[model samples]
Target: MKFHPYNLSRERLLDFYKNLLWPRLIEEKMLLLLRQGKISKWFSGIGQEAISVGATMALQQDEWIMPLHRNLGVFTCRNMPLNKLFKQWQGDLDGYTKGRERSFHFGSKEHHICGMISHLGPQLSVADGVALAYKLRKEQKVSLAFTGEGGTSEGEFHEALNVAAVWDLPVIFLVENNGYGLSTPVSEQYRCQQLSDRGKGYGMEAVTIDGNNVLEVYHIIKGIREYCIREQKPYLVECMTFRMRGHEEASGTRYVPKELMEEWAKKDPITNYEEWLVKEGILGNEEITTTRNELKQKIEKELAPNSARLGETYAPVAEEPTSAQSSLDEVYCKEATSTSETAHHGTPSLKVEGTSVRFIDAISSGLRQSLRKHPNLILMGQDIAEYGGVFKITEGFVTEFGKERVRNTPICESAIIGTALGLSLEGFKSMVEMQFADFVTMGFNQIVNNLAKIYYRWGQNADVVIRMPTGAGVGAGPFHSQSNEAWFVHTSGLKVVYPSTPYDAKGLLNAAFNDPNPILYFEHKALYRSITGPVPEEYYTVEIGKANQVQTGVDISIITYGSGVHWAIAYAAEHLDISLDILDLRTLLPIDYEAIRYSVKKTGKVLVLHEDSLTGGIGGEVVAWIAEHCFEWLDAPVMRCASLDTPIPFNTELEQTFLAKARLNDYVQKLIDY
Candidate 1:
């Protein structure tokens, strides 16, 4: 593990010394770029160039890649068209497709290269999922994910490794130990002597090699990749490299020793290997000089076109063109009809054709029907494969549909979201389930930033159905039980639906699948087992944004959804003399504004309700819409009954007290009396 040296023919070594290779020149130029103010930062793989090149060369052309910031040296050398590369380095629009990504965070669609993201450890999960996809399709390809020792600390890293190891996925995880994380030394960051030892925790085979040796890197990476493909196994390869550059371009002086700079400079891997090549007769003086000079020239030529126009390139923009697509205007549109699972079915409802289905089974059944109707549908998430998902909603999916459609994902929320986006772009109906909707927060980048805005900006329908198991009654507490419906309910371009009954779960799920925009299906974990209604064996669809008027009255409108809807109905049935109109707002954002208007017109009063907090709750929006557009139709001021602005309590008494204090649906009859 200390070092790897090879005895080879001088002629072979000389030929391998193609200094003009894109990577050699890129590292040198990037450092120059930092000095010239072209790029504001540089995280060099200076003494670590060999591992970068070795791992990259070992990958197949079709297999996608996700590399960290420092691996620009390998990425540049991989023939990622220099024009876009320079723009990215210079912070121009063209550098990254959507000027939204960081300069070092770039991807090449032409090369099947995935864009780099900020959460370093999460990319490993993405690569694992990508490799899993290849395996499912029988493609015999592998995806490589690269990160530094520092990133190995992230929980996502462990989750990704565990999934890959347990599934026998075709993925290669590479760790570049540069001995430092920002300013902290590796000794202080990790307890283990070698970072590779961490892989053992996941039951993965680990290989550690000196990163400075180019031939050694090539040898190890080549063999590992071959073994992975031949046996369909995942491997962790740690390259022990050193950094010649500081943590970043701006931190040249924040180090421990005055001699540290000189010490690492003398050990520069590129220089050391070139020298060894010449001394061993593997490379002649002319060949080495020519290769180095040519590499320098090619890089210069590639970067020259953008040196003057740096930061002037076009930015990557999202896909919204019409307000109809941007907002929840597609609640029911002509296009939705064409894409409907049953082209002729209209406004299907909960009919007891005699099937008792669990809430979770309803989700899976709805999905299965949609996928069967539309072959473009694809489902992915952690343990969704043989394990059938943590909740078993995906149980028996792999064997029934096979792996191509049903998949187990690496625990990278962002990567899972990103790959789902890509698959959506390729004309697949991507259905992503957050293992626990609580952890969906980890991929806020993909959800809020990417998935939400794709259709609004691109004018294309990104039909991604994200199912989240939300609510707080299961004793999972805090992290796993936070109610997140309000977060997306307030966001535009999203449809939020909560189905309390299995029958409604199926109908709404089908409607969600038919929607042209992204939908957030929040399933209350408490309802998954207990709340079973009659579900028909045949497929059905509900009209999104259409409220279900459970009761007809003229005194007050008790508007609610999800868990709150049931309480609203129960309260109305118990107090028929109060004359209450129980209205269930099927879709949160598009909202059945017409139904609410009808209720307000009939009763001249309204009582909005929900399980979420009153502060910025969906009820507020409905009340505001009534005030603004249907003010003449109102009789009294709109009233809202919602959860208290406090965390869901673990104690049963406190929870009941919390619900009582908020009065949510319990206040429905009271509001009617008022």
Candidate 2:
């Protein structure tokens, strides 16, 4: 049942054995190192080595692989140098998470492998995206994405599979069904008997293979790969494997039931494959003995430390990176470099040329100006093409620049951000629109997990500006009307900016578009048309962390941003009875604590406000920051006048109760009266 011609020759098989040997050792070594407290953590592909080895052996060196965490086997099976792999395990800069990248987060252009994150389902889609790009690029290359069974539970799995099938992409989506997600078993995770059965829904090729059998995995992967190059039809191979260890090194095995372990342990992948190899005359008992000794000797000899760097030895530790360290930004981000040669920092003054410029036109003008200066910039979201976008902000981009630069996505948020990550890795400036701010959460994982974490991991910077039309006064219900900036404000490694005026919008946006990290640029739906201020003719940078002071009053400090700043301004302009000091926070993540302190010290009173529901809104953090930093300076208890904690009710009257401007008058009156 197991003899396959694709299995390597005696010497090559021995080499394959050598290849197969260390990855397991590496995976196990990492597991132990984690227990030993050397590194923080890693995902183990111990039992599924057959697939990584088999599938990798199926491809040529030039083809690219987009691998999930459970892909240590691919490296092992391909006989990638063990020392470098071990160094990577140690979380050293020498390790391939490619320095600054998380340990085990593998990427090597030289190896033609683009390593993936621990996130499960997106690789399936990204593999397709990379393959699509390659096909268009006319490269003789194929892409493979490896994931686990639990990843199949994700909506993106179906989305990617369907799209790849529809487009006939040159991608191989290999699902290594290891029968568990942490402690959850596959049966509980899926209704279908076989994971591969779901592929029929996509109308592409699909098959289930014995994941433990190396030759079976190899031949199946190889055949589909050839089929892909010949027909360009994507393939899906489901490897019904087992999770031989805990999810990661840090996870305790206590959650796993004894019966399940006993069951999986009986089918130990390495042992079963070895027996098969021996019975088929591929190897004798002596060679198997020799291979085991050789592997054990290497494992014992290659002892050091876990590869990943834990979040610092202490919290709030500043990593002071120099300009040279920052120069990694230049070569690392392809998009960042693309337009640098052409980008003019101080863009010449521009007169408003058009006669009938709508609110959306302003948005387009700003984007066009920024794009003109940044050639690596690519804009695509929903109907942002001839449709000019849902808001008509990008109306003529497709016609002007063509689809390659102004693309039309299939409404896949993960792919949008994921592809943007790929582009950003090569220094491209990515401006992704989420259609609306509420939908931004769909792609939030990619932004937070990959884009935001990139700089923290491998020093890979994503100069990406995620623009979203946020806020809810105009009555778009729970699904559409939500002020989600607070969510991003609380996340680390992201810069959140909510600019109020056209001038600040253009200037602050210019600065954000230039920053090295990912930025959530929120444009309140309330301010897009109504709010207007003088935008200077020439491009100028607005400091990201500094807040704008609208007034120098002594009674109270009204703190707000985005549309709320306008409300605060209006409230101040009208009622001079209590000259309340106003502070407009530009960057929420890096909150302007200095401004908060200065204003609190001046007025001895504080009122934190926002249009979002008061419960756990971003105001809470601002209040906490003020309390911690300016407690003694407070006159009255720092007050918070946020919208009542409820969804933006569809009724206009109810909606008014939840808006910052609607309720802000009362707060101002009370402050003045006090």
Candidate 3:
């Protein structure tokens, strides 16, 4: 049977042809640039351009698109200026990422397109959040997220589908099954006959279509999009195509079978569509030549030296705003004049004096107060809505704020963070709870790559807080108990906060809510009920970057935070002979260097301690900083006492031995004696 184009008006057919031509020309030009060593890398969608073009054309102008690296057709179909797109490849200052990134790692807020990272699957979850926002706002807009068949194998792929299906969000998951993931063939990637079939497990309608058939792809996507908007339910469409070329220019077709490549080459999407148009008498050969020539000229014009500012290093012409300027620009940026500041100026202050509360209660109170103050605040986590989270810290929140504000999510940590990022982009403050800090590994890519870098890259404040219930001691073994603050502290563009006391937890959470950046707020699980302190009822904010000197002395300085704070204080009190100065570094990322310098200078000895694994913990960074800055003042080498470099054991005695508090005590005493 001969192939025929799907039924469409002549004008629509011609438009699809033009859309296909632009990306085809762009891909050819990009390959030429790659060969000439003008660009660093190129991931060409030579045969699969139809998928991006078709899916993008199906969406409305206001709808969002979270495109992958190969979706240049989507950018073109959206009328992204060819000059800006070329400038991105040339790494020019006028590019979307200001030359900081290359290829498809850039997007425009004006266009409602999200810039994607190398980790492709996380964007699927992010698109879920965008769709969630549309549903919440009662907008008929739907989000389209594109990924490869290989991306479907990622954990985030399943997580995103589950969340979107459960929430009935308006999102279309487009899987461009190009037969191969890099050099690995699809046969080895998955056992399923069709990648879209996995969506059925998540209770969503799924379908597979010929990706090379541009008109069919467009028709199917349009219908799916309409259905999603009408029903506010997600649908997955797998477009089966082939990657004619290698993954990149450098990787030739060495891994692909010559016969398979030859077979797929004949069905090249652009050529096949062009042939159909010509055969059907919709477009003539002369018109096809004219269109190709015009597209080539346009691509060349964009690549012109003057347009790209070539030969000179491109630098940002506009001065980037400082942190203070950014803070002042935020709508939620209001300085707390005093600890007793209320939600409104004229309203009576709700401050309570000497009201003792457990650590968990303090956190819950802070969340409750923040939600009451900000109508746009959203709380999400697994089992948070009814079960009130695993620790019951968010108990009664679903009842008080209603389920719309307090959400229970599926067991999808990456999606939770990614969706929170989506909510934050829409000017909603989202506080996502990681049931346990150990599970943060599941969402690490989204947190570090997407959540952490969003603010710095595009100047968009990701006003999101990731509440990590962390630490050991309660016999929650390896996967459940871990002090993972060090991981986030190592990542730049993230604020790490770990509070030991009830007062600090309540106050710092308020401050985090006000801050216009992503904050990783860690709460020690052991301290949830084991500790209690006076917390004010009114809205109060503890300065994010400041350290509190819990105890004052001049002999030896012990620096700690979270669970370690209690141990250090107890040890200091037990030995009256040692004059100990304990400093609780509530914020790890923005370490109070001045306070550390002052304490080390006065005491002339320093010991940094934490409950995280000893080798790569935050303590190592502290010790390095002290040695670099306060080496002259130090009377002894900076010491550190942390949990042994091993996973937390299930046995109570083994766990106690693993996290030996005596080791910290011995280190502190030795520092004092030295």
Give me the overall lDDT of model 3. Answer: 0.83
Question: Local distance difference test, per candidate?
Answer: 0.70, 0.71, 0.83
Q: lDDT tens digits, residues 1-674, model 1? A: 23234565565454344522456567676776566555666666566776767666666766777777777645654667766766555554434433434666655545656544565665676576577667656777888888888888877677678778877877888998887887888878889878888778888789898787767777778788888888888999898777776767677646746587677667666677777766655667787678767767777787677655444333333333334342444332225634333211112233357578788788878888887877767888888889988888878888878887887776666666755665543345678898777888887766765566545432335577889988766766567767778788766667788877776788788888776677888888877887776777887876666667666787887778777777776766766677777777767766777777777888888888777767877788888898998889776788888777888778766666555233754565556556
1-674 per-residue lDDT for model 3 (tens digits): 13445666789889999998898888887686667666668988889898999888888876889999888888888898887777677765567765567788867777878868888898898899888888888988899898898999898899999999999999999998988899888989999889888888999999999998888788889999999999889999999899888888788889998999999988888888888778889999899889889888877776685444444443333224335555334322233323442221111123447699999999999899889878988899988988888888888888889988899988888898999988876778889998888888988899888887765565556778999999999998998888888888877678899999888899889888877788999999999999998887777877788887787788888888998889988887788898888888888988888888878988888888888889989888899999998889989999998889988998989999888485877887787667
Q: Ranking by lDDT, best first?
A: 3, 2, 1
TM-score, one value per model = 0.79, 0.80, 0.91
TM-score of 1: 0.79
Answer with 2 or 3, whichever has the higher lDDT.
3
Clashes of each: 13, 21, 0
Mind giving the per-residue lDDT tens digits that candidate 2 earns over 425-512? 4456777888889897778778777777665555557677888888877777776788888787767678888877676676667776
C-alpha-based local distance difference test score of model 2: 0.71
Q: Local error of candidate 3 at 549, Å?
A: 1.6
Identify the runs in model 1 with alpha carbons over 4 angstroms from their true place: 1-21, 27-42, 280-338, 341-361, 370-466, 472-482, 487-495, 501-503, 511-520, 525-536, 540-555, 577-583, 589-604, 620-636, 649-654, 660-674
Candidate 2: lDDT of 64?
Answer: 70
Cα RMSD for candidates in order: 5.6, 5.9, 4.6
Off by over 4 Å in 2: 7-11, 25-47, 60-70, 77-119, 132-137, 163-169, 178-187, 191-193, 226-233, 242-291, 304-359, 536-541, 551-555, 576-580, 631-636
